[model samples]
Target: MVTRRLVLSAGVALATAQLSAAKVFFREHFNDEGWRERWTVPTKWKSESELGEWGWTVGKWHGGDESNKGIQTSQDSRFYGIIAPLDEPFTQDGDLVVQFSVKLEKALDCGGAYIKLLGGEVDMDSFGGDMPYQVMFGPDICGSGNARTHVIFHYAPKNENLLAKTDVRVERDRLTHVYTLHVKADATYEVYIDQTSVRAGRLEDDFAFLPPRQIPDPNVTKPEDWVDERRIRDPAAVKPDGWDDVPKTIPDADAEKPAEWDDAEDGEWEPAQIPNPDYQGPWRAPMIDNPDYKGEWEQPMIDNPDFKEDPLLYRRCDGCTHVGFELWQVTSGTIFDDIIVTDSLPEAFALAEEGWARWKDKEKAMWEEVSKKEKPEMPSFGDEGDDDLDEDMAAAMDEDWTKEEL
Candidate 1:
């Protein structure tokens, strides 16, 4: 027989083992002073450089107030790229979640606040829009089509990618909010905004993961004699007598002749134009079920021979050793912090609860203060105290000011 203490000890050991197994594939709070050593910024960026000013600055501000530290954009119309290595390859298995926080300190007119997960160690110096990436996911607040989080997966040869059809909109205000993308091995995915699940669906259905399951048969075609129209003009119907007698226009009953009008000079000043009520549009026979109607001529669907199903839509980039951010910010001053990639939801949320949660309240209060300051104050009328003049002013103001304007 096993002793009670032995069972308790075994349970404790098991719990500890499980907790230890929960690992963070990659994380960068940028709070440490030695962040430059952990991450690499392209040295080829400058105002006169082809990549333009990579105006990225690492500092602390009360806007986000998370750890009093974060990476932010310092100038407008610039390219900012920062890449860092991951502890392990991030594949689509278990529960891969990419989470981060973004605060649009400046109203973003056009810019991307997204991160790219490249497949392997890439030439840091040449990384830009042309670089290949496995996953590019994050919130992007910009012009019309870019006010939501982008969740794109690299499909194949460079430049080929599929974007998630269902994405959640992000707040563009100066308050910090968390964005998370959770993808599983079974092809199902979920997007979260500020710790709340906003969208969830299967990757195959939500995205064009594969070619269509069925396609129109190329061997068949609609017959030329096919009556595709549901209704046709009755051949036996004829126009009623005097149908052409009704004119399209008539003299207006209310329109009076202009006193300065001269019939000889003002080409036919026939009373101001008015609609001819008696006139009816071209007449047509009452629509009846066409006897020869063969219904819609839709080509029959055939099984797509080229279509192939992929059960493992999520695969660990066997060599994806780094994650980076490469984007153009128009307004700039967008702070990014608390970035983490993991295979456990609890682990990801735990990190957020520690970093984001800690300063969210303070950030909220600060934004509220800013809003209070920036918001236009409403105009106030009338005196502070009620006096005889108040009643007199109200009465005097009751007079038609439009007619008495001085």
Candidate 2:
């Protein structure tokens, strides 16, 4: 039963909702002082002097006071690895969902702001990118072409796939936004950005986890003499006389020599050439439908010989033990908070409302205020370029340097 209700506020809708039925695997609000005990940075990351560090803060702005807090990537151009395991291991016997909130407060260029679910023994000291993970869900933004939320499944005996579509972008805003991925036991999945679903489909149709049901027959081949052309030149049409003889350009008849023109000083004066109005472009015979056109040729399809349908595509997720963030960022200031992995949609909604929904407006207001302040003031220069100052720019210099040269 995969379901998502557009919950505006957790207090109003799910205030009495009980989480006992959901069997939560993990939840991290990061509001407690002992949050340091919840997450761990890899030993390799700690020893390396160049790696970025993590910090707990309320970020630039929020609806609440210091209570609104999350773990933030506090440095630039570094690789970070951290993980926090659930109490125990559990199979995907029912619906599995992973969701969280992220605020990309500054330059969010190239980075992996996603969360990973892994199942394995402890090697906390050495955990890094090479660590195997069962599932990875969240946004991965690089640029326009590579911005998207990924829902990956790492199944045993060879299975790995990024969420099946292209350009499934994430919320790239300075303010807070919730990202949720719900994978149902029924083999369908839904990806939500906030309360609305942006993408949803069957697991088989979306991911190439199973072999195709059909394929082109190997025994059958397209005939070499197949008349696949739909149209051809008209044989009955004849070329008009003197079609090629028409000049493409001619001297401007209206143009005249100036009175100061000198035949000796300047090469013999001649009117500039112009496109000949009477000239015809390269002649092409009018095309008529070919009587011998056999339409497009296609190889006959047959049952895929190597295909074997797995009735349990949903089971490919298996399960996970730990959820972590192993990412690389070019420029940091990304804050991650309010993480939860469970089966209850209401619980997810409850957390979203208590966290993101409540603080989003305040965050937006702070963002607007910051953007207004970030506007660059017109720097005064000598009188040379002052005359060239654009009216709008002179009044308010270009805050964005991308539009024109300085």
Candidate 3:
């Protein structure tokens, strides 16, 4: 019989091995005071506010997060961006997952709360709108395409850069929700919002992965002699003999000539015209299926030469050393937290639960509280401050201060 100590030792060893095998390439909760050490903010980053500032702070408390602090945008009309280098690069293989939480405290009229994964050779100091990224993923709200989560992968062909089309429109609200993108090695991708799967499909089918699988045969054309008509007029159908005999216009029975009519001066009198009841519209032969009836013709399909299979379509980025936020906000107050990139989906979800799930309810309650709170009454000009002046001066300046009365 096996000893209990051996079984206990094996269990501990298995657990340790599993932990070591787990690939958590990068993770940030924005909790540490030394967060600046991990993240870098560009010097040229700008805000459209009066101060023209970028308000990016860690350990920021807005009374909506479970933690005492999180990364938040403190002002309106700003472009806030910060980047952190990964410890290791992600190659184009295996599984890849990106997860994060976003809380829109302001009614975002226009904004992009998305993150970019940059390649190893990116210019950290000059990271801006013009900088190219390997992947851009997150929620973007603007105009009619509001609350759409983008999962765009960049592909460079010759001198042009194109993005894959994958947009999953999400519900717009001012509450924290977790957004996750899980891409498997089999070219399949799944998007999860609030731990619920919103989209899932093969990358090759969903995106413009390759040139179309089939194309219309170039040599074949619709021939002029093709008799493809399915219907024809019935030759047996004939019009009635009285068809045209019915007069289109007839004399009105109820109408009488004018009482004081002058025949010579007004020309020969004619009865007022009325619609003839027997009159019918034009007639044509009835239709019937043609004896040579043929079904609708379709252009024959041929194998596309440009179509090529990509087995590593869902693979991770190679030499992707940095991840960052590069976005524009018309009205700010968007908080980002619990950003993680890993090979395991469970780890990403667990990280989201720690921050987003724990505080979303309380954050929603806080929003409701502020919305329902009564506005404080404005102070009257005739109130306490007027007492400092003389009685006559106070009376002259005060008395409701209505412009019409003045």
Candidate 4:
């Protein structure tokens, strides 16, 4: 009875374990095109303001200058400012994902993109000023001449300030690649570059927060409110530190130089274009989708098997290979694949490597292709499955089965 009870308990435990292991949740893709239509752009936010805020335009794609063909906005700045209402206020508990598509005519300096979440008051200038949130793809700076472009992921909280930046470069000249970000409220936040899991971590606790300021009184102007007179020590007197007391130097005799001085007869001095450092490609947010929940689905890699094998050959023939290359990530016993392609690999790699070197003085990994070889297949389970059973029966027969049958 005791042995039977123990066996029953063990069986029940094993059944429960199987049931738990079977439950799995695959990520959903969220679309930016659909999301943009659902959100509104705030007032006082001009489409193209004097402060160079034109990059904050809304809509699917707003074509820009000829030089930046296929770009939604100017290459000089980051594009799109999306303001949407959440059904429930964002907290540190729920999961959220944001994705989009971007292309570069050619990479530019300080040119990169990111998605910032704001829970409290959001100041666009500060990129989520006082919000308790994270940025999936944070801002990045492109190296001089690299044209590598791909999706990048930045895990929030942990990547607070400038340290939180990770990017995956895609093949050059590809358009409309998909990218995804997975953010769970309490658990680890993950960023998939293309579809590759590039980063995962907890939210950092040391976010900088400023004290709230009181609204200025409209009826009476305070000293600080009056811009011109606020700093006046006396109404009729100017302090030594005031602008009037400061020495203003006039141009000397030789100050009036030629507008095009020291030219080589052609024009102003043109610095030689420096090759882009490795891994300095511009980062883009790819597309996301969230259709009805399906059982543990996997996103297939947009195949470019001959990417490195025939770089120039495929770059001209296949646009997909030209635009980006795929990436792979292993998480929770599952593998996720993504792609990164830019207009230029040699350029983007140089830029990414340069940026990495600036932050940390480490040498970038040299690109190499491992030789592939074929191997013989091993026997399947069916071929060997009956061996153990046959051996056991032979032993039993030798010991007593023959005598019993006789």
Q: What CA root-mean-square deviation does each model show from the true structure? A: 11.4, 7.5, 11.6, 31.9
TM-score of 1: 0.75
Rank candidates by TM-score, best first. 2, 1, 3, 4
Structure candidate 3, residue pairs in collision: none
Candidate 3 lDDT by residue in tens digits, 1-406 = 3698899999888766654676987888777676778887776544333222334442222344333455776655667777888778877567788888777655465678888888868667667778878778888876443458888876543222334365696655666778898988888889999999999988777776567889999989977667688889998888988787788889998888898889988888888999888777677887899887556667899999988876666754656788998878766767787888887777787677676777667666766765454333322445666544354423322322333311
Once all C-alphas are superposed, what RMSD does model 1 give against the true structure? 11.4
Question: Estimated TM-score per prediction?
Answer: 0.75, 0.79, 0.74, 0.30
lDDT (tens digit, per residue) of candidate 1 on 1-406: 4698899999888766655777688988777778878888776533334343333343323534334577787766778887888987665546677888887766566788998888766777666777888888887765554478888887762346888777666776667778888887777888888889988988878877778899999999998998988987787778898888888988898887789988888876766778898989777776666789989999999999988877667652435668888988756778887888887776787778887777778767766665544433222335677453343333222221222211
> Candidate 3: where are CA atoms >4 Å away?
1-20, 45-68, 145-147, 157-166, 223-232, 244-281, 286-291, 374-406
Selected candidate, larger TM-score, 1 vs 2: 2
Q: Using lDDT as the measure, name the better of candidate 3 and candidate 4.
A: 3
Please write out the lDDT profile of model 4 over residues 262-370, one tens digit for every residue. Answer: 7767676444434333323333333334233243433333433322221121111111100110111110011011111222222222322333223221111111110
Error of 4 at 222 (Å): 60
lDDT of 2 at 368: 83
Query: How many clashing residue pairs are found in candidate 4?
Result: 49
As a whole number from 0 to 100, the lDDT of residue 280 in candidate 2 is: 78
Cα lDDT of candidate 1 equals 0.72
* Each prediction's whole-model lDDT (CA): 0.72, 0.77, 0.71, 0.31
Candidate ordering by lDDT (highest first) = 2, 1, 3, 4
lDDT of 3: 0.71
